[model samples]
Target: MMTMHPQTPDILPRVAFVATGGTIAGTMTEDSKTSWAYSSAQRSGESLVMGIPGLLRRAQWHFEQPYSIGSQNLELGHMLQLRAVLLRLLESPEIDSIIVTHGTDTMEDMLYFLHLTVPSHALGKPVLFTGSMLPSDHEQADGPGNISGAFEFLIQCLSTNADVSGHSAMPFGLCMQGLFTPAHRVEKQSTAGLDAFDGPYSVLANTQWLLSRNALEMSEDSGVQGQFASLFDPTATRHPLFEAMEVPVVFCTPGNGPLRQLTDLLNRKPASVVVAAPGHGNIPEACVPVLRRLLLNGVSVVRASRVIAGGVEQGGEFDALDAFRQAPVQGGNAVFSEAGGLNLSKCVMYERLRVLAHSLSV
Candidate 1:
């Protein structure tokens, strides 16, 4: 059930805490030192909020638990449902921002999905994602600290209207270890470490601890927002890709066997096929012929890199291929951004193609 926190003085900003249950809400084992072996979704959003010391006083807050499952079980349907809720919340005049507690495993993918599907016009408000590496009941549980830190970050942004890029609006972000990282740049690096997430390609919003020994430290203005508006039109009538009947992602390797494997994936008639190519989005020379055939047949084959940084550049083997030489291949460059680090562009491209395919069918 959803519940609203009492509004504070009119001067304070109102925030909505939407808990989608992750390790942050997980129960601790008897030993207390180990958090891996526990029941997820064991706690509610209200309970988690109350656990944060002095958090209720920081802002006017509301709580909702739309779904309480480990991120490993998250499906496309869940993302679609979340998007609907977010759209509704963003429309409210009372809510100033949103904080989502998610499981770490699929957090980045969810952020990417939301980054593409959420309407740009409604993105004026901030949406922050945070979760804990340890369970709530653990002695040094990081969930309360993370939530409090994120709350502080959001409160400060309430008066900020400037976008970091100065061109597009940045409506979404994540806070880890008190560092305000844009959503597209954040990547989970450790499974159990308290400070597990980091921004790969961008500078830290604030390197110093925001909340040390319960003392609050506000983040400095980075003058940057995740420029999501450039990815798609705010007025576009595209449906959520997760709602699509099928969206398969096929991985491509550099072996001679990749040609046959790639052919088999194309025969399935997927909405899109993303090749996890080697460095710089290079497909195996042997596999180029098969990719060309599929492209000729109107299949959307995106060339994505398996490496972590520096996105696929244009004019490579892909450019020399028959399909790309004649016309541009549906590569992963469209999703690349300075703030979008590595895997984000590829993830967004996969779902973007899926959404385009669904729009055509409808």
Candidate 2:
């Protein structure tokens, strides 16, 4: 007879893996080295999760595959679908946390869309998103490591009591960039870095978990579903209300054309115009006239800073205060301006104008 060793206790928290296919699920065919293909060989999300070295053994795991499409092929409708699924999960009490395996290509856009649509409170839970730069089938692929890192991050968040419960009034917390971050501030910093995302504000504290509070409160009475249905109609009209809507985007340089170029773009009768101005959303004295002209022409003119890492602060020389105090209010809506700087501002304006057009139609 032999003495038996004592069993070690399990300490990992239960995790739910939501696999939205990307390069992580892609494989390379031996014959065609030039082509990348997806294989059903490792099709199931659960099987993929179990294939990871220690994830399944460490935690009680669950899996759901909403779709197996590549990330590059993702569309706005797909994002809405993903949001619907996530909303359902957030409403459920059985799941402890969520991990979304996604492609890196459009991850930033997806993150921003989620941040804007989901309420701060629903964000209180530990929802981690991770993906690999390399395909899973490659010998030196980063997929396994990234997945392992995500699982480890979830374990750390739960074990440290950082994923707090019942804190439903605050924004949901997200762990990305091989660390934790808020969805709004999550952005990609490098094309091929393992730790690609950067959250400058440090919105996520290791001890804090996001609480889902004040989500856009879905209702049967609301016509949002009907509106969404209309979007799918092949005959639905898609048009921007203000024609030739264009924004002049320029980075900070000593002598980049301040306002002349912006005013010129506005002269084309763009419904709205955005200026990727210098630091703190400031424009040179020369550019103010261009802004004024656009406003006079009933063209919406917005100012966003050139800074990539921080928000444009108010109370600067080129701030909207002066425009607000002036009569006729030619300046456009500053609300359309975004903190992520020019590119994001463009996207925000595009979406805003799209909404405005829709409202006009109905």
Q: Model-by-model lDDT, in order?
A: 0.62, 0.55
Cα shift from native, residue 189, model 1 (Å): 3.5
- Which candidate leads in TM-score? 1
Q: What is the Å distance of residue 343 in model 2 from its true position? A: 6.6
Off by over 4 Å in 1: 1-12, 30-36, 159-171, 201-242, 245-247, 254-257, 317-322, 325-345, 348-362
TM-score of each candidate structure, all chains considered together: 0.75, 0.63
Q: Show where candidate 2 strays beyond 4 Å.
A: 1-14, 28-44, 57-60, 68-74, 159-163, 168-177, 198-272, 278-290, 296-299, 315-321, 324-362
- Please, what are the lDDT tens digits per residue for candidate 1 over residues 161-267? 33423213333667767776555445676665776776443233332322221222112211122223343343333445435534444456545566776788667
Superposed Cα RMSD, model 2: 9.3
Taking all chains together, the TM-score of candidate 1 against the true structure is 0.75
- Whole-model alpha-carbon lDDT for candidate 1: 0.62
User: In candidate 2, what residue range of length 10 has the lowest lDDT sum?
Assistant: 217-226
